[model samples]
Target: MATIFTRIINREIPGHIIAEDDRFIAILDINPLVMGHTLVIPKEEVDYIFDLDEKTLGDLMLFAQKVGLAVEQAVPCLRIGISVIGLEVPHTHVHLIPMNSMGDINFSRPKMNPSGDELSAMAEKIRSFL
Candidate 1:
C-alpha cells in the first residue's frame, strides 16, 4: 500500500503543496504545530531517513533548506526548526517548523487545527516565497 505521503505526491489525495521538484515535494502539515509547519518529503517512499542512500540524504536536506527558507519568510518566526521524527508516519519526512520560541517545536504539545481555508492561504503565502 502507498503511504499517505506517497498518495499526496501522486495526487491520489489532496495536499496543500508549497513547492516541488522532480525529486521532492513540500506540503503543509494538516495537523500543524505552528502556523507554517510544513513537511519536506522525497518522491521515493523510504520508510526511514537513515535508510536513504548518501546522495538522497544530502539532496533531501538541500531540498528541505530551500523549503525552510520560504516557510521562514512566509510565517513570522525567529527561526525555522527541523525535526525528523518518523514514527508518526512510515515514510521519511523532514518537518520544517516556524518557531518563535522553544515551545513552538514541541511535539508533545497539542497541534493546531487550522481550517482548510487557513491552510490554503498559508500554502499560497509560502509558495510566493519559493
Candidate 2:
C-alpha cells in the first residue's frame, strides 16, 4: 500500500500543495503546529530519512530550505524549524515548522486543528512567497 505521503504526492489524497519538483513535494500539514507548517517528502517511499543516499538527503535539505524560506516570509515566525520524527508515519519526511521559539516545534504540544479553508488560505500564502 502507498504511504500517506505517497498518496498525497500521487494526488490520490488531496493535499494543500505548496511546491513540487520531479523528486519532491511540499504540502501544508492539516494538523499544523503553526500556520505555514509544511511537510517535505521525497517522491520515493523511503521509510527513514537517514537511510536515503547522501546525495538524495542533501537534495532534500536544499529543497526544504527553499520552501522554508518562503514559509518564513509568509508567516509570522522567528525561524523555520526542520525536524525528522518519523515514528508517526512509516515514510521518511521532514517537518518544516514555523517557529517563534524552540517550544513552538514541540511535538508533545497539541496540534492545531485547522479547518480545510484555513489550510487552503495558509497554503496560498506560502505559495505566494515561493
CA lDDT of each candidate? 0.96, 0.92
Cα deviation in Å at residue 9, candidate 1?
Answer: 0.6
Candidate 2 is scored at a TM of 0.97
Question: How well does each candidate superpose onto the true structure, as a TM-score?
Answer: 0.98, 0.97
Worst lDDT window (10 residues) for model 1? 68-77
- Candidate 1 structure quality by residue, lDDT tens digits, 10-99: 999999999999999999999999999999999999999999999999999999999999998999899999999999899999999999
**Distance (Å) between predicted and true CA of 57, model 1?**
0.6
Candidate No. with top TM-score: 1
> Model 2 Cα displacement at 53 (Å)?
0.8
Per-residue CA lDDT of model 2 for 23-104, tens digit only, reads 9999998898887889999999999999999999999999999999999999988889999999998998899998888888
Model 1 global lDDT (CA atoms, 0 to 1): 0.96
Could you tell me which residue pairs clash in candidate 2? none
